[model samples]
Target: MTLHTAIVKTEENKISSEEAKKFILSEQNGAESIFVGRVRNENSGKEVTAVTYDVHDQAVIKSFQSICSDAKSKFDKNASIFLEHAKGYVSVGEISILIAVSSAHRDEAFKICRYILEEIKHKSPIWKKEHYIEGNEQWLPGYSLRPKEEIK
Candidate 1:
């Protein structure tokens, strides 16, 4: 079953990595994998100021849910999946997103977890704006939805 797929919007909040860890353990599968993203102190030779995240309210979340549902069909009905992505100002070493998946075997769990992470980065309407040390902010180039790339 697809469960705990979420996109958040706020100033800043701590993501409970331990909660995710516990959930993964409780699922009790033969294999498990986790992906953890962190905010860094430096980027492109610039001192990192902070990152601002903005995501399409409904569409991004629906996309997340769909990823889980489809993975379940291929892997196993008991395939456990979870994702938590952050929004707003994030500092270095803070968790940006946590993805954990478990399956009956090692290979299937690894593939599903990796697939979900990349699919989220590519397909979700989540955008990030970089705050540079020079007191300038810029949205990631080529990330803004172009007219031609509308999800029609």
Candidate 2:
């Protein structure tokens, strides 16, 4: 069967920009929106050297599928897309995640791309281990799970 979209590949899989571009362009569409998540050199006030990503494998992939499925339902059509995340050690300038969406119109692509990226950040089971300048690293907590009811 022809894949409607791809939400496969776990933490061990690495994605390239070329792959994302190809995935988004394969289908004949008028427009596209591509979002690339990359590793930067700073987080909070710390100077980051690299970021190690980890995921609760099954949950991460499931979350990705749900995103794609939801987009299709909301948009009422299949969008050409590539959803990828990484694991192991990723240094600065490396791609941590990539999302590309192609639709008949730019609005659909942009809307879906934005929705996917934001939702993934808020909902995915992936965590980040950030390496700082002083030779220290720390694993981050998932922000979406913060109990707002307990914040008070």
Candidate 3:
């Protein structure tokens, strides 16, 4: 059975890797690859107190679906894609995002999981702010996946 891709909205909710795994697991898929992103305690020698994420839900979900579709075309069409992202303050070591991919083969699962994660980081309409222990905070610049010619 072909599963509908899941793009979970985790606003004010903690991300769960187990939940994502359960959602993507299937009898037909022999292999599953998961990627969990956690907030680190430090960045560039600065002590990180917390990290917060703000997302444009509609746009991000659209982009996520597009990425999933691209992965299905490039990889295995039968693969299941599951993605979840936190949308509020997350302390160090807490999960920030989860990507799970399941396919009949291990290679396809691994490749699609990586592709979904990279696309989300570089293309999604999600904004992140890093709060430092020194009472300073800065918004991180969003990376773009588009080519220079496509950027306005």
Q: Which predicted model would earn the best TM-score? A: 3
For candidate 2, write residues 1-152 as lDDT tens digits. 11233333434556777877776674557888888888999888889999887777778778888887788678737677678778678888888888888877888889988988888888887888999889988988678676789786
Question: If scored against the real structure, what TM-score would every candidate get?
Answer: 0.84, 0.84, 0.87
- Which model is ahead, 2 or 3, in terms of TM-score? 3
Error of 1 at 152 (Å): 16
Off by over 4 Å in 1: 10-12, 142-152
Candidate 2 backbone clash number? 0
* Ranked candidates (TM-score, high to low): 3, 1, 2
What's the true lDDT of residue 4 in model 3? 41
| Tens-digit lDDT string for candidate 3 (47-114) | 99889888788888788889888998999999988777777788889888888889999999999988
- Minimal lDDT window, size 10, model 3: 1-10
The residue-level lDDT of candidate 2 at 119 comes to 88
Best by lDDT: 3
For model 3 the local lDDT of residue 61 reads 79
Number of backbone clashes in candidate 3: 0
